[model samples]
Target chain A: MHSKKVRIITVFAAFTCLLWIFGLGWTVKDYLIGAAHSAYSPPAADESAAQTNELKIIALGDSLTRGTGDIEGKGYVGYVTDQLKKEGLDVSLINLGIKGLTSERLAEQIKEKEIKRQIGQGDIILMTIGGNDLFLGGQTLTNITDDSISKLEEAYLSHLKAILADIRAVNTEATIYLLGLYDPFNEFPEGALTSKTVRGWNSKTMELLAEDSKAVFVPTYDLFQLNVNDYLFTDHFHPNEVGYRLMADRVAALITSGGGPR
Target chain B: MINLVQNEMTKLLGKRRFIIISVIILVLLSMFTYAQARQAETIKERLGTVDWRTELQQKIVDWQNRLSSAGQWREQLQIQIEQSQYYLDHDINPSEPGAPTFIRGFVENSAELFLPLLIMIIAVDLVSSERSMGTIKLLLTRPVSRFHILLSKYIALILSVSLVIFIFGLLSYIISAFMFGNQGWAAPVLTGFKVEGGELNISEVRLVSQWQYIIQQFGLAWFISLVVGTLSFMLSILMRSSAAGMGTMLACLIAGAILSNMVSSWTSAKYLFMVNLGLMNYVSGTAPPIEGMTLGFSLAVLAAWMLGSLVVSFAVFMRKDIY
Candidate 1:
């Protein structure tokens, strides 16, 4: 019979061996699953390579890219892809939009060791941000006087400029289409201060885009406001599936039109 | 002193009791080994025969396309691809003279889940079984000092538990190796898997022999099991009934597991035993629970708990009236 202390210690050792070192194939499985949860699980190797590059566009944004407000979750990204394919454009679309990410965060992700390979030179980049800036700052963003407006605008534009810089850095020849903020406040009944700031931010976005020849500004401001209640997700702010489809379709059109200066 | 301990143990583990327990331990170990083998079979079926070379290529392709696809995971896809490519490029598959895939599996699975359960089963009744049978009185009547007797019984129980566990380990290793052979002891390891803020990453991925992994796992499991065993044994002494001690400790163990699962949101619960069960997570470099606690924290918590239990157990044992 084993001494109780020694027996206990042995049990500990044995259990340790079992959990920590037992045939480790299981650990690999755990690792794989964990990796899959956050990272992309690429298509099976057997997947046929793209037949042609009629146009391979990856939409990178947040809820809008995800079709959050849409009934079917087919945000504009899907719509644009469908429209382009219908138009005989060979297009492959990848949507890498995480909810609740600010432009700062999205840029950080772009700089990751991982995103480098996903973006391609000559590929079109469709990006939508500023929703979170509105969500987090809300009415507080509107309180800026002319004196502070310039200061705040400088800060906001600097961040956007940094993000745009990253997109170019990652994909040098890529055309970056930055979607301005939609007017979710149009349907905001009576008067909400946050709604006014949403409009101000949209103007700011357009103003910022005017300085750059390459950064095309897609005006989603007028579109979502037309059917604020129906096109928006239940949250009443982010575009619903239909709204996203519209956004995606708009960007797809711009990608094809090769939009000239307004 | 020896007489008291012998009398206590003789009555506690009556000839029939001794045989039954020994059989039970052996049977449990055997069943556990059988189950482990079955688990390996299941993995083999799903993952396709454990050929790491093929698996690596498959992973690389999968990772490459994942980055190419858009689900807002483009960045992560890049990282995952690079890591997989690193392994494949270096030719460090699991079969390439390293810890077999199972040892890698053990490292992932060892934290907080299996180790505690084993300790719970083995040590919860180390003292209470005798007390529950009301044999403490008879033993106390002998001239042997209670402390001496308790110490000897403790030694014996520890020995039995250790042998049972070692055999359990050996049986599992043999059963798995029967199917895996050198695959059991050699395979490359990838330990950088992380899920923070819903983000994932991986690194290191060096090759270590499965045997070495087993040894490492053995050391880890021993430390964890010791913590659990000490705490449960103390509980057994305080409760004086096998069922009560076992039931309480089992509940506690289960609670720890459940708490660990949900504590990511609760955050503060990380200080509790439930969140600490998978203390190995810290060592494995998964983010610590509650944003800060490490393996060291969990160890300290277990140590404190054990020390507290010991104080209570000793105080009660040293002073309680035998009658």
Candidate 2:
């Protein structure tokens, strides 16, 4: 009986061994085949730029641009797109926002091999970025450049420029509207130091707008600043329904005016 | 006495159970490690292909911009963006999931579900079996006293239970190393991930060493299993019939385990032996469960219960009218 039990145990052990071996081998093969396929046929960017349309818009940068955390939590993209439809404007927003992305991260995404092929001439590029970078004390330099509030601002802009250059590399004739960083700090009445950093950041944003008139600067600073208590939420940051509506109105007015492609 | 335990240990050193359990663990570890290695290699192959993060973020923001923002709510999104930004700045992706968490160690984690049955198989009929065959009465009639006979069997039971726990833990340790890699040995465990509104929040804490972690994890399982085995041994003595003892203990063990998860709201249920099954964590330096009976408290409760059963067994075995 003991010998019989031993034989049974041994068989069970051998069977388990065989199962693991074949299963491991299969896993390796699946990964190898997937790797080979990706290499053999690289995923290319979409070539159809919707040339039949009178206007083409690309929404770029982080979650805010992605329009995920709005009041409906569907975000600003659908609302803005629907509002655009309200006035017969041929438009489509090419969404390219990566969550947990700073300006540098966005720059990295912009340089993706597939995205380069998709951006085209005469496209309208709308972007909301740099808020994440600024909030994280993204200041790379210890000394503030009068040109920028903190030395890191210099580094941050270079990253932004790299992102811009990447887009321009693909579509030079596209009109890019850079939304100036709003005073999310305005709600923080007691946060004088943080507000200074916010003021300094906003200053640099305006200066960049002056530098490129062809690039329209949509001022969101005032939209979120007024009735700061009423517009702000319990978190004392971001926008409520009133604030998002103001944002939609600002963007709609610009596109309705047919802001020319720079 | 220690040497006797050690000698019994050597008897099990090359036993089939030891060899079989170890190899099973090693093979599992190797397979998981190899698969992960291959998958990571593929990810590296297409490292520069797609910027999934930006694409995801863009989707979030497009949704953010379109939705009609309501009252005092924008502040929360601001915090989300800021918190999301922190992860971005650090290049950390907390959402990437794999492997059971550290507290829930591989071997012992499954042990709760299956280890109890294995223990019952070996230990249920331990003392009762000798009596069932009338061999125990023959031994008692010999020159040796009843205490010595009982003590020997008890020691043997302890040794066997310890070996099983060690083997179970050893298998998990070696296998996880293969599945997760050496890096995973040091991989951060989000001990208790806090999820709100379908989002996982990462808190600040240092990672514990893998080996030390395994020791603590095994320690907990052994303690719990020891409690379980001890209870079965006590039951084995009280009941003259091995089948009766094993069946009753098995039902109680199963019922205890099932009740802990199902009727969690019952405050009185905390005293149940099954609820204290996580005695593994107690010995390993973790905080007690919500309003849990403490380690000292639980050990005392189990000890009293065991001592009480042993008292009843000694009295009945020494003087009971057995046919």
Candidate 3:
């Protein structure tokens, strides 16, 4: 019995040593191979689900779409997604919004391959742009000027047109909803100048949309025009949670009513 | 010498130490697996209808922002960005909860801390217990030179350390795979980010299979465990009391872990063996506790300490009287 126990113990230790050596060998071999194997292409997505998703929302633009100001980290896009799910629609969202993306940068991003692929697969697309352009890209409010605003608006219009063209190039069937920017400086001393400039930008955006039957410009200027202080984030520029919800409610109503096809 | 080693190995193997350590490792692994499962569930619930692409993008940007302000965490954030970018670029969805990748992640994270502690537990009393138990005289009276006896014990300690780490890795993989699944070994992992002049140079990032990553991580982890075990072995020889040896080593290790984070600016702290023990961080492209501490530098520091310890231990064992 004593010898038998010793034999069993010997075998166990030997077996463990073998495994340890084996594991070490395997890792050493892999480390060498890994050094040589540098390029990696990720596996493809599930084909069946990828092709037949019921609803897909692709959002692009600046911090509002990125949910920067909202304490919950859920911008208008989150509210829209929740409302869509509540209404029993299967929703999958692709949001590609950088924090400080101007209209020009966004136009460039729209041409990128990843964004193009997402736009191609989207059933409903949403966007918010030109805020950084007209607001001097988060500069001090005193830096605003009527003449500079007009100059920024002209450049922003061409970029927004190019952006729309890029989206339409890849995706002709998706319902394109471009969200209009609101004036967070509506209660400030320069409120009138900013609102007027934002309205001019909106009018130009709406005119561009008029040329395309599938694209609709969702207006949010009126949404925050009254409760500007309440809707404004602590930064006094971006929209707070209540402001995003208001934007979401408007977009949700539009989608439920007629935007998303039955 | 070989016979002496074999005898020591037999004695070490026969002890209840192996059983206790294995049980402890198994219990901890199960707890980790359970917690991981719960976390995956919560993430799934929280994600709801958000697509993986948006989530990955958000995570990437968030890490980038964090990287800008956090000098200590740049390596981690850089790796996160690289991984997320790969997922986005290749159109591969981020890993689901309770997947093999998650298990691999857990193994990588715990190896540098838990694996070493387990090895320390077994090594702390290697020589001290024999002396305290009055077996040192019997050990000394043997025909073999005292050096052979001490060398045998040291070799046995190393073998046991390797065995424990092996068991921990294998058992962790098995248990986590059971909870999660055995898929995703083919998943691509990013590596090769290195720090140059205090800034991470992510230009050489490479993608290797998940299996490759686990194997490499295990190898590095084994090296770390070996270093830790040898340090404790020397302590056990010098202190002549298991508790004191183990306590001192543990305090130094814990203090090193803390000081590495808080005292990166203090140049003298760089020479601490504990500060240099995070060798895996260097292997994985994370910066060391102190600036300019490269993988080669840390390896050299550890090797010197290890060599110094072996010299001290052998000198003390050969000359000291067995009372």
Scored by TM-score, the top model is 3
Error of 2 at A68 (Å): 10
iRMSD of prediction 3: 4.4
lDDT of 3 by residue, B1-323 (tens): 76676777777766778788889988988898888778656644553333566556656655644564667577656755765675577676556433557656665676667777888888888888899999888988878898889998987777787678667767777897798877888766666666666566766677666676666666667767777888899999889889899889889888877888887679888888888877667546666677788666766787788888899989998998889
Residue-by-residue lDDT tens digits, candidate 2, A94-137? 56665445888788767654455545533678888887777654
Q: Which residue ranges in model 3 land beyond 4 Å of their true spot? A: A1-53, A108-112, A136-140, B41-55, B61-79, B90-103, B197-207, B262-264, B267-269
Question: How large is the i-RMS for each model, in angstroms?
Answer: 12.3, 15.5, 4.4
Candidate 3 DockQ score? 0.31
Report the C-alpha lDDT of model 1 over A192-247, residue by residue, as the tens digit: 55455557777878787777677788888768656677777667777777677767
- In terms of lDDT, model 3 sits at 0.76
TM-score of the A chain in model 1: 0.70
Candidate that beats the other on DockQ, 2 or 3, i.e. the better one = 3
Off by over 4 Å in 2: A1-262, B1-104, B178-208, B240-244, B280-292, B320-323
Question: What class would a CAPRI assessor give candidate 2's docking?
Answer: incorrect
Candidate 3 pairs with clashing backbones = none
**Residue-wise lDDT of candidate 2 within B20-88, one digit each (tens)?**
555655675566556655855554332212233433344344444433352434434543444444433
- Which residue ranges in model 1 land beyond 4 Å of their true spot? A1-57, A66-75, A78-95, A120-124, A131-136, A140-162, A172-177, A187-218, A249-262, B1-113, B126-153, B159-217, B234-240, B254-278, B285-323
Please give the ranking of all candidate structures by lDDT, highest first, separated by commas.
3, 1, 2
TM-score of each candidate structure, all chains considered together:
0.56, 0.44, 0.86
